[model samples]
Target: MNKTKNYDLTIIIPMYNEYENMERLEKKLTGYINKARMKTCVLLVNDGSTDGSLGRIKDICERNTDFFYISYDSNRGLSTALNAGIDNTESRYLGYMDADMQTDAEDFDLLLQHIGSNQIVTGIRARRKDTGFKRMQSKIANSFRRRMTGDTATDTGCPLKVMWTEYARRIQFFDGMHRFLPALFSLEGANFKEVPVRHYPRTAGKSKYHLWNRLRKPFADCIAFRWMKNRYIRYEINEKEL
Candidate 1:
């Protein structure tokens, strides 16, 4: 793809040892780009996958004109990968989805409709395909987060989301920032809307999330978010001279 080409939306897919999923991801994302309602491109962030995922990502981007990527030498976690994507993209709008193929890239269109009014438009997985225990853990974590942050987002963890790049760039990146995007945006006084979207089971690549990261870490991060929220700074420019 022409690095200088203008794009209306850039979908950021964070990949961490997801070599098995790359083939399907390429097919789905390519199809989405062809029929996307807006001028769209894909930004694949390779987070130091020790596997041959980087080779696959390179090949995919090389074959597809709309695909682009950035990679680092060491694993930096999901938040770091996503932050890199946010900081690097030049598109007006940014979308995020995991490389697991659990969330459909085509659903970016649904979130795009609300971008005109909402600073962030996120998807709430209507029928999740995870196991019972995983679902329960998510439910509890979400409840706790809502109580702490007061963000009314039903599913902040849903990978499918779209937001203005400006607001996305302002988010305070942290270890668990991916799980708190709605709350982080709210801290910047950005409006958010959640719409239900489709979800699927992971057919390839082992799930990266475990009980510790999904439940315990989020508990710790929620307290940290509260502490930061109390001292968070916000300001507006009444006027400026060029």
Candidate 2:
């Protein structure tokens, strides 16, 4: 049986080829968890990094307090990592962030403040520190996605996010689900809040996304999301017998 945690929240960080960011990630997260408002723990989900990051993640988790890790033998991409994290989370609330060091871990307190009666709380990266071309591409993609999914997410790709574990586990798993989490959560009639969070330029590690995958892939996934929206099931029982 999966061991259920007594912590108030579990933060799940998914990593791929993030060997260079591991040291800074540990420093940042360790400092954040020490002062966070809730009793928080971190779970590092390694999606089969070939850059020796898997070993580094193991090492950090061993030394850091309330840090745990799980890894895949092969690279399975972001969606798989998220699903696995949800499946293993042993807490009432599950938060998510990237290992790229682009977003601040401290802003989790801001997101947590608004999670009351909300199934999900996500971040909007304020003053994004990216190339103009990269920003433009993301803006276009987010606009297209909002039109397709009818969700009011300002930045669906922002890696900082928090959600109730029950609602997160209810999400329908799909190949590109990470890009459509807000829409999928809403499809289940769950409430979510979006808060602005800090963004920073990456100091290390190469980004895994490129023009083709960032733009074209999400476009296709939006269509898939539309199809799922049409067939999604919802139900309510007025009463149940013991």
Candidate 3:
């Protein structure tokens, strides 16, 4: 078992080749966590970045009281990074965001305020800031995903999300699982809600995902998601004695 934590929220940031943005990312994230109404801390998962990102991440974690970090050997996809963060964290509530400051960390407070009675609270990317091609790909992918999975998530790929630690740990992840969080959580029979959040364009580094990797790969993974959905198990013990 991992050590338990008393913090109200833990923010998990999965970073890959984001050295240029680490300085601003850490400063903004730390500020938000520190000033948030609830006590919060940041956990950065460095996904084997070849750039100087790892060193920068280490420096931030060491110098900042509210920041911690972990690193993997080779580059893993976003889903894997998120899973690693969830597995390592000890907080009661876990929130996820990308290393890019596209989504403001301050918006976390809005979601956190209404987390009551819901196991998962996610953000809807309001006025999404993305390239034209990226926006087109997202629209196509999201349409197919909603029709196939019936997840009803307007923006499943939104970077800002919060969930109960227990429910988050129970999720099954795949390569494209990052885009299907709402569906997966629903499969676990947990309640969820979404609120609009601000979005901004990348200020540093480049996006790791492209059209094929973002759209085509996810289309294939949707089949895997479907299989998991059909076979998912849930139960309630009316009476238990241990």
Candidate 4:
């Protein structure tokens, strides 16, 4: 676990089968890294994309010194990829965005501004470009999630988020952990802020989520989160010496 403290931020992009979006993603990310307020790098997590995504990822990493990647043999879903990135990142700050490129990489600057005082800074997609049905689904899901988790996050599903690496590594990873980040961070006594960010339509890769996984599964996962919250352990020591 060598902590490479040289970089101030590491952005984690989780890719499943987004081969089509790789070229544009690399260009946009490279532009961000070049102009970021702090030293920044990218960590591409390839969640076993059967499409030729791994090859593209390797090529991208080879071309950019600030880019890196990790891949597994089988698809493990977004939460697993996120946890892997958190476990491996050594930067002071960590960020997450989808490979589909619906959110702008430059919005990370907006989130980074709040990272000094908050454990997590997440984005709320203002004037979302998603279809009406997708927005409706998100509305219902967010409403239910707020009621169930009491996280009060208007848009937990928004992939653009930045958090202190210490707090991010403390998050408990589960099948649907991505949807409960704010709640899980809260369990660790972490505070977060939300900023409005720009959103774009998906021009390249198809979205991986659908009605069942986006809505029904999240409802079930919320129940699971509540159960874990009830039994979650927390303690503190008055004094300690190493």
| Candidate 2 structure quality by residue, lDDT tens digits, 1-242 | 44438688999999899999989999989999899999999999999899999899889978976898889899999999989998999889999999999999999999999888788999999999999999999999999999999999999899999999988888889999999998999988989789999999988999988899989999999999999999998988999999
**lDDT for position 220 in model 1:** 95
TM-score of each candidate structure, all chains considered together:
0.97, 0.97, 0.96, 0.97
lDDT of 3 by residue, 1-242 (tens): 44327677899999899999888997898779768978888888999899988889889978987788889979988989999999899888989999888999999988988777889999999998898889889999999999889888888889999899998888877777888998999998988899999999998898888877888888888888888889988888999899
* C-alpha lDDT values of all predictions: 0.92, 0.91, 0.88, 0.93
Ranking by lDDT: 4, 1, 2, 3
Summing lDDT over every window of 10 consecutive residues in candidate 4, give the lowest-scoring window. 1-10
Clashing pairs in 4: none
Q: Candidate 4 local accuracy as lDDT?
A: 0.93
At residue 146, give the lDDT of candidate 3.
90
Against the correct fold, how does model 4 do in TM-score? Answer: 0.97
List candidate 4 segments past 4 Å from native: 1-4
Tens digits of lDDT, candidate 1, 85-194: 98888888989999999999989999999999999999999889999999999999999999988889889889999999998988888898899999999998899999
- Quote the RMSD, in angstroms, for model 1: 1.5
Worst lDDT run of 10 residues, candidate 1, spans 1-10
lDDT of 4 by residue, 62-148 (tens): 999989898998999999999999988999999999999899999999998899999999999999999999999999999999999
lDDT of model 1 at residue 131? 94
Task: For candidate 3, list the clashing residue pairs, or say none.
Answer: none
